[model samples]
Target: MTTSAATTTETPSVSQTKTGIRFWRRLCRNRLVTVGLVIIALQLFTAVFAPWLTTYDPTAQDLAVKELPPGSEGHWLGTDEYGRDMWSRLVYGSRISLLVGISSVVLGLVGGVVLGLLAGYYRWLDGPIMRLVDLMFAFPGILLAMLVIAMLGTRLINVVIAISIWSVPTCARIVRGSVLSLKDREYVQALRSMGAGDGRILFKHLLPNCAAPIIVFATMRMATAILSTSALSFLGLGAQPPTPEWGAMIAAGRDYMWTAPHLTIIPGVAIMLVVFAFNVVGDGLRDALDPHMDVTYES
Candidate 1:
């Protein structure tokens, strides 16, 4: 009897898992989402295997072969103004861009969720926290990031911090809205009435319920983070010279734009492609996760 009862209880969960798998398979059929996933996967793979993919060091320079156009002397994408292989730098640069984007989003997500939960759950904290969020929103994002970068100094970690700080307000607002809706739900009230602690109620009940929006927002925020990091690097506030960061490479190549356009164009395209991929993926997530959307998967 015990074994039979356990089997009966597990069946619904197994069925739900199969249903989720089918839904995901249907979601992946969207052409734009598939392309975005492919592009992102390729970038991550290239970043991870950069050393094996290219023989030349990303930072190595040869003045003798500087500014060679694409397809010259076996350099596939050509050499930059510094004669460093553009293709190698690009491959390596993906690591930095992805790292910064992902790390900053994580930092923002953690801080934002905490603040958002506090504000949404407690009437006393809401006004002050929202006012702070408004203050953060008042400044243009890039400008606020630049200010923080200026204060913190320009290192890779500092760049992540600056971008994360900029991201916090937006994340907080999104999470707060979600939490406000969830905190009053029946399950949350039941948990509270059952003598569950605030921590449990927030983490177990509220946070999980709000996860879809949080995930969707984080996906979209990653694209912005990448673009912002690139912009900061271009302005000399991000990765230092010879760091193989895409934005820093663009900055180095800007002076040579007229003489060697490939230097600028290659890295620029890399940034565009990565950002575009993230945006498309975010859009797809929004559509897939939206409760109001009517999604039907054909059998």
Candidate 2:
């Protein structure tokens, strides 16, 4: 009996490991996913080692050397209008972009999950929470962000808050739909019949089953969060000047577009790459998580 119980106890862990390995294999089968992973890894590495990656202080300015072209003497990738090294500012900007993206997604996902869980599990709360979610969803993400920023005023933290709030409605809907399907499943029903409390049933049993969609949603949402942050900054409602944020850098470089186009081009390309990476990875994740896609994927 003890041996049988031991085997049963180990089965779930072993099955989970096998599932994860299968997911990884499926994800890596796509060459674009490989490229996306490499880009994301490099971006993370750059953000962590930003100080050492570039010698110049990103915020420091020198009028004398301002607007120097790329590969001109010690400064490579040129200097912005403020004469700060573009390389350094770009490197440091990765830190801001990643921080905002991750922070906002986490906050949004948490709020969304809680609301979704309550709405899904308790029939009484469903109408009110879903109506609130509907109201939020009525506006575009950028518009919602603009309204939030207008009310709260602009700061990096406010950018996070705005983006997070924007994210919540989408996330909530995703999770709510997932939960509605999962709550009536046999495992959840079994847990409920076994006298497990609602919290345990909701969090322990139902949540795990809902994870695949959430994971895919969050991965895609990161791209939107980063892009939105940059957009707001570009409009002068996000990061202030001298912050070395990619959007702010582009905003400053707009005046020099005719002469030193690299100022805008460089950061624009960075934003494009980062957004592309996240999107491709999100697609890969969606494919991997969806059982329907499994038969289509090359072995």
Candidate 3:
């Protein structure tokens, strides 16, 4: 009996190790995903080590040296109209963008998952919740966010709240679909027959099954959140001046575009790269996780 139990435990351990190895092999097979991972890693590194990477304060202004071109003394990417170091601002700005993106998505995910669980699992709640989701979906995301910001007044945290609220419908829809499909599966039916409580069945079984799609959607939505944050900042409704946000920096540099294109171009490139990286990574994750995809392994 002892030997049999030990063998059973060892078999599961070996199976789990093979599963993990297969996942990594599939992930590495996608070239675009590899590139995206590298870019994302670099952005994270920049956000975490901004202080050590740059000598100039992002908010510090030297009016006398305004609009210094790229490759100018000390300032590699050059100075904006405010004469603040572009490189430093870009480095620090990554922190704000990533923070807002991640936090807002998490907030949305929590709320969305709860609502979706109710909508999917309970027949009585489905119609009402779906109608509410439809109402939210009627408005464009950014427009809804702007309206919320207008009503709530502009602040960093307010921006996050607005974005989170705007994101709820999308997340809810995704999760509800996943839950609807999962709730009727044999495993869920078996659990129901086994007298599993609603909470236990939903939380332990349904939610865990919905994780892959939710993760992919969240990754993609993060890019959208970053873009929305930048747009709001550009419109003067997000981060205030001297905060070293990329969008605000671009807005500040727009007037001097003819004379110092680097100011606008550099930050624009940074935003583009980050968004693109997230999108590619999301695609990669979807492909890797998709059971329908015929993923090949190298022998």
Candidate 4:
């Protein structure tokens, strides 16, 4: 007990730095993680350098070249019904998808962490917060998002807000569970006994301990958030037409599916690849971060 408190109170940075190094080393050792990282890196690179990667403006139109097949003239992935360059829109669309995914996760994380900390630390707050979370959980994730969007009205930012609100329940529950398990630990008790304030104890000590699950949740949530954003856009509750968002593009192309399959196929493939990349990466992180997740073979 003394040793743990001493370690927790003293040299936290040094210990954390060493632990992070070990964690990263273990993470990089997985081949699946390597592949996930490569895919994520490529998507990030494409998102960042979208303009340079594709010459045509994503929104520009030319009726003469509309609905062309892949490899038609300068349009490598072909043009949509509006003659908008599919490749350009796709590259640009990465920015929107990644942006929305990251933003909503961050917002949800903030709200969840606050609610979780309060609920776990304060006996009086637990019931109310948990009940609120339960209320949120009563609705399916997509349906909850839809409800929020219904009230907020459709737009890119609205999509992020709706998704973040939908995300709060799961994130809060995960964090609350972690806090419940951790709040009674020797280190936490020691901190409390040492006259540490709640803020310091919760944020400085408890938060760090809860990081692994939160990180795993956030990573997995990224895929869901991105998918949700696309789903909303597909359903016309997200980025409107002429915006070139992947989901909007998919929605637009559904009408031309019989005549111009590439319009739908290309963007759909992008969503699939991005979502798969995040899922694999999230899984890898979960395995690496979870100390009790060892697999054993019985004789």
Candidate with top lDDT is 2
Candidate 2 lDDT over 101-184, as tens digits, reads 999999999999999888988899999999999999999889999999999999999999999999898888888888888888
Model 4: per-residue Cα lDDT over 1-299, one tens digit each: 99999888879889889778867777777887888889899999999999789999889998989999999788889999988888999999999999999999999999999999899888899999999999989999899889888998998898999999988988888888888998999998998888999999899988998898899999989999999999999999999978879998999999998999999999999999889889988988987787753332111
Candidate 2 has its poorest 10 consecutive residues by lDDT at 290-299
Please provide, for model 1 over 149-177, each residue's C-alpha lDDT reduced to its tens digit, 9 standing for 90 to 100: 88989998999999998888888888789
Rank the models by TM-score, top first: 3, 1, 2, 4
> How do the predictions measure up, each by TM-score?
0.95, 0.94, 0.96, 0.91
Question: Model 3 — TM-score against the truth?
Answer: 0.96
- lDDT value for model 3: 0.90
State, as a TM-score between 0 and 1, how close model 4 is to the true structure: 0.91
Best first by lDDT, ranked: 2, 3, 4, 1
- Model 3 residue runs over 4 Å out of place are 1-4, 294-299
Superposed model 1: Cα runs more than 4 Å off:
1-6, 294-299
Task: Give residue 162's error in model 2 in angstroms.
Answer: 0.4
Tell me, by TM-score, which candidate is best.
Answer: 3
